[model samples]
Target: MYKSPLALMVSLSTLAQYAAAAGFIDDSQLTLSLRNNHFTTDNRESRGKIGNAAYTGQNKEWGQAFVLSYASGYTLGVVGFGIDALGQLGVRLDGGGKAGKAGVSRTPGQLFPLESDNSAVDDYAKLGLTGKARFAKSELRVGTLQPKLPVLLSNDGRLLPQTYEGYQLTSKDIKNLTLVGGLIEHAVGRSSTNDTGLAVNGGTRQSNKFTYAGGDWAVTPALTAQYYYGKLEDYYVQHFVGLTHVLPIANDQSLKTDLRYFRTSADGANDTAAGRAEGYAGAGYASTTGKIDSRVWSAAFTYTLGSHTLMVGQQQLSGGSGFYQVAQNSLPNEGAGPGSYYLLTDRQVSSFIRAGERTRFAQYSYDFAGLGVPGLSASMIYLKGDEIRTANGPDQHEWERDIALDYVVQGGPLKGVTFSVRQASLRSGAVSDLDQTRLLVNYKLRLL
Candidate 1:
């Protein structure tokens, strides 16, 4: 069954009021983090359509973010109580032009809000709190959550991390087994001040209830398995299974394999055309409204030797619809669109998730520690996708290349400071040819 957002919030508030006993202030930890981001994208498409050309030029933005967080230890008792709080602020430094800013009423702008004239806003800020309680081997948290599970990963690919308001429970009563479940009612985008309901990709209708459950089991020392199930009211239901294993070959060499599978189907109002007409269906197909039905699987293998690693993977999508993931980008009058899915092919620019698509990818990475630079690393990757579903074409195809470099201060006053850069080039028949770049600097401080 589904629970209303109001009911959940009220229940949490009531429990927190009663749990506010002693030790609340004695065992708390606070931290602050700062991040600077610069983003640039160049679209090389020259199509004649106005809508296509809107995103066909240079788009750039620079911003900074400050995150303050506090977590309290449990109170002294059989069943302990605690609370967590988070505050975030984002300020834009450049890229205020209204020509190419992504300020979609439903989708998000790059790093700021869209004004009435479609220009970027100066700044945005938000605050969140969570009340928590713990038993012997189980814990419950209600309110703002950044879930990192495979089925519904929280998006942190921007100035601020995406958050959700909900109720979540976790248990580790059985050895090597971890259980998790949650009821999510609302989502806070990576660059928004308000919360919105949830929906599938390309969907305009919103659903308030998102229920999920999952578990992870460590079957052996080098092998672990995962399974999860998620459902959005009136939209669709999905199931995921994953496996990971590592085998040591030599003193410093090993091979790792990761496998993931997902099955999704329409539910409730999205099951038929009449239901879809009422605003409950996935978009991005020939007809613009299609039922959710897909089966996707991906497997990747990595071999590491000393400071070098090489990886290769392939992902296949089969069905009439693409992969199903929650995306609130089309909500009315909302200027934030943040969504993420757990796929090997999900990259900086595009996610190779179109229907009837098959993607092949390869990557090479090197650690500079062997060369006396302990905190520096570099990697490059290439991916090609084919067999895309299209209405006007026989078949569509695309390819992408990505390069990344990162360095962190190993010691000194800036011990935790890090710098990173990423560049991507993509060419496709379905969309456009594009180039994107990102530069980031981050630092964290511990404040008791």
Candidate 2:
């Protein structure tokens, strides 16, 4: 709300007279980033759910984005105060159609907002602000928030990033442990300029309130454990637990293991069959009408040697329901809702979290620096999921493979600039077979 120069200056003036004026001014940061993205996708199958070509076929789009970020240092005092700001602008470059064209009424692609005649907007902009206060080892932030906890994962897969409107409190008051809690009211999708209420996939209704609490404990220098709980008002209640451990196999070799589990069930409106028929429901195969009831678990292990890293994982979903996460698809012409879930299987294409699905995945990445080529890297990921539950069908299966290459300017004027190329292919019996590719160029500037 403090958009005017006068309001911002007033807020800044209050910091000087506080306990530590130097801390407030000395620790401030301002940065600018330019990101160029080109996306292309090919759908090997589809006649459109609405029985039209508008929602099927190939999709290609390009865009340029400018992101400005600023973080102010807290005033040195018993209760420190600070502020954060994010400003973004997106310019359409080319293309109109989106990759996935589902639902009844299909709009234009997901890259940019559509005009009155279903044309892409030339440009769009957005702003975010956060006010914060710190006491001892705890900090409370109110306003725009981006949470990266187990319960909530902010998505940044598109030209811009997904953000939330709410307040969050984080504390390190306890030794060897970090505590976090937040209350979010709304979410902005990756390709959306407007903030919408929260809901599950296929949910026709929306809920504005989402609450979460969690903590991470460092059991030892090589081991950590985590637990988190989240609830969407009148939708579902979810719980998560995780463990991570690392062991040194040699001076230059190490192995790491990660385990995660989630339990979710219906609540409030979704608690009754009548409420589900009224529109409060989840996506995929649901044993109890439209209710949310599922349990998911995954375990992964990684081995690192010099510049080579290999990781393998498996995940399973049970209870006649798909994985539960905050997704807002109740509206028409929306992208894949909020963002990516915190799962090893969350990749460039399918997420592999279908109902009763069992997924096994693997990845291998290498750093070119080991071969005397600094700032270069490559990675390959593959995932296969089977035993997908369906209401009318016997069963289903799907698989995806992704390959990526990246390089960064090591020196000269273009130093710190990055170039990346990513390609993905998916084969499935659920939606459609597809191939996707993305190219990105990025540069960052430090203004302060």
Candidate 3:
């Protein structure tokens, strides 16, 4: 069933009225957050060789966002019910007339709305509503959602976070275990003000159904395991398994290991040749077009001592096909936007998830608190990927190096203010070469 905005508003209004009259105000909460963002990218894809929009060249933009949210407590009853509302406004600080062209912000109207000629509009705003019902240790939510799971993770690389329209159920009735199931229909991109149907990468056909089920189990005090299954109707089906363990070596030293695996296969339209011709195919590097068959696995290890941490990891992808993930850009109605994957290689500049690819990564992170400088920290990362399978041939490779710094006000008039900076350099034989930087400031306030 489809509903107009007015109909949805009326329904929300009725729910709010009922909840208020039932004396649920005692547990309600409201908050407002402000964020300022400055992003720039310089892509060196060689003149006339820029096949992907992400490598279009020097693109830069500045924007600010305000997020206002309210959550109402459940009503007094055997089965409690509640409501949540979220509203956001984004405004452009500086951008116009082809100053840059890299991420969504470079598209003029992406961060803000667009004018008649595709120039950036001054500002744009969107509102969302969610209703919740709970019984015992189980809760059901229907409406806007931001989910962080092995199957699907929301993107927040830009000024605002991506959101999905769906119905989800979460239960923690069993000790040390969590169960989650959901059905997603539509998604609002991190940059766009509109909603688009879901589809796999490179699939122009849109499907409103995305089903998923998953669970997380804490096997022991230092070990955890996870399993999940997800399917995008007519696109692909995927299964994931994950394990994490930590071993304490000494009072101040420990080793943590993280492992992940994924298996994917074509489904419905994507499983047939004719269906692929009709735009139901997978994206990224692959030997065959539109065929979704792949296995990917990765393992990471970290050693921590005092304020210093060191990590290394590697990922491998089978040559049958590239990894698959739901993205709105692949939908026929959206702007062919870029989406992210769940992998260690999904970094600031690129994702090393190509067919037959193998990636190795390392990182060093330090906390300033050990040096008497609280609320400050920094990290550096380097990743290399090789043995990619492409239509032309194989043996392609890419690498990226990144540095990040973050600081927060510990105590003062602006106690909770934060500032962060990130810089990255990427070199790729198959994709494109580029340098990028991002600066962000954030503050939050209690409203009620």
Candidate 4:
């Protein structure tokens, strides 16, 4: 029998609430959001007969999201209980072959998913519910969960964010420290209602069970540290440590520093020859010869003064191969897909920070608010990644420059609305690609 756990939880919670002597529905909130985006990309190769000038194309996407959330407070009991529900809907508009079937909404269709004939479906929807219990500063939630830890982050980059069907335990009993642990078995992709297994980018087609535990500690008012351990069944084990601090500088100025380190190695089933024979090749780089281990470190510092902030960072990779993660089913960005927001030390360009690779980056930003314009901002960032070591050739290098502008309406009819434009130029001596650009506009509306 195919039964939906989310549906069952919501039903059971509602029934239980009716049985209670007195129940209070704490809050019921609804939100409606619409986002329209026009994306264009042009790829130009510097060498090779692979085509000198890649064609230029554009895609227009329209997304509508509706969320209805309900939370109930405890009913005068020692153990507090509650229920939460979320419903989502997405639709495609103005995106087809003529406008450049550059996205999932056209071409093979399946804008969201394919029908029996393998054509794109124009609309999709999903419902999720979570039952929770809280006591003191600890809470346990089962069913739909959106975890935001470094090891297990929910991707919310698309029309509808991905969600996990799992259970999570969070505790903040200790002052200045927060603890989180979870077991996730499945994930629903941004464009799909079906829950699929987990995979890393450029990895084999298989899903591994994910288990993780971590904690963050605020060592001081201006300093914080974090450590986490993550495991994917039949694969590698990952450990991460991070530290952040704010150093006071001149008058009304400060320098913020962030440092992160990750060490990944094979374990359990991945270490056994029989396990290797069964396709448990670990993470990072996997070849017919053997698997590779990886260690990466990054440090960044930002100086804030007046309306401007300047940032510089460097990253180094040492190991048999590059950093590794679970296989991914879609594009790569800041947290998940392409065009990710590099947080100072993110060496995403060329995946430099590959084995034996070193990368350096610098960024500058100015907020017009201090100069009387509250909603306007501009930023420019440049990153140079080099020393990429691979068996194919000698060390290679690549560089990219990005410029962005943003504005948000502070008041009036469109208050809280935001607009953003981003442009990038990339050059690589090792790779043939030259440049790319992305523009995005987003807005949100709250209905309660």
> What tens digits encode model 2's per-residue C-alpha lDDT throughout 6-27?
4444443343334134466577
Among residues 3 or more apart in sequence or in different chains, the pairs in candidate 1 whose N, CA or C atoms overlap within 3 Å are 106-329
TM-score of model 2 vs. true structure: 0.90
* Superposed model 1: Cα runs more than 4 Å off: 1-22, 25-27, 46-55, 98-108, 286-288
Q: Would you list the rank order by TM-score, best first?
A: 3, 1, 2, 4
Q: What 10-residue stretch in candidate 4 is worst by lDDT?
A: 333-342
Clashes in model 3: which pairs? Answer: 59-100, 59-101
What is candidate 1's lDDT per residue for 88-124, written digit by digit as tens? 7787887776344353122224777677777776777
For model 4, how does the per-residue alpha-carbon lDDT over 374-428 read when each residue is reduced to its tens digit? 9999999888887776556466677878788999989998898888776766676
Task: Tell me the tens digit of each residue's lDDT in model 3 across 120-239.
Answer: 656666778898998989999999998899898998788777789999999999999999999999988887777888887788888899999999999999999999999999889999
For each candidate, what TM-score against the reference?
0.91, 0.90, 0.91, 0.82
Score residue 294 of candidate 1 by CA lDDT.
Answer: 90
lDDT of 4 at 25: 40
Best-to-worst ranking by lDDT? 1, 2, 3, 4
Stretches > 4 Å off in candidate 2 = 1-23, 46-55, 97-108, 332-336
Count backbone clashes in candidate 4: 15
Our model 4 lands, by Cα RMSD against the true structure, at: 5.1
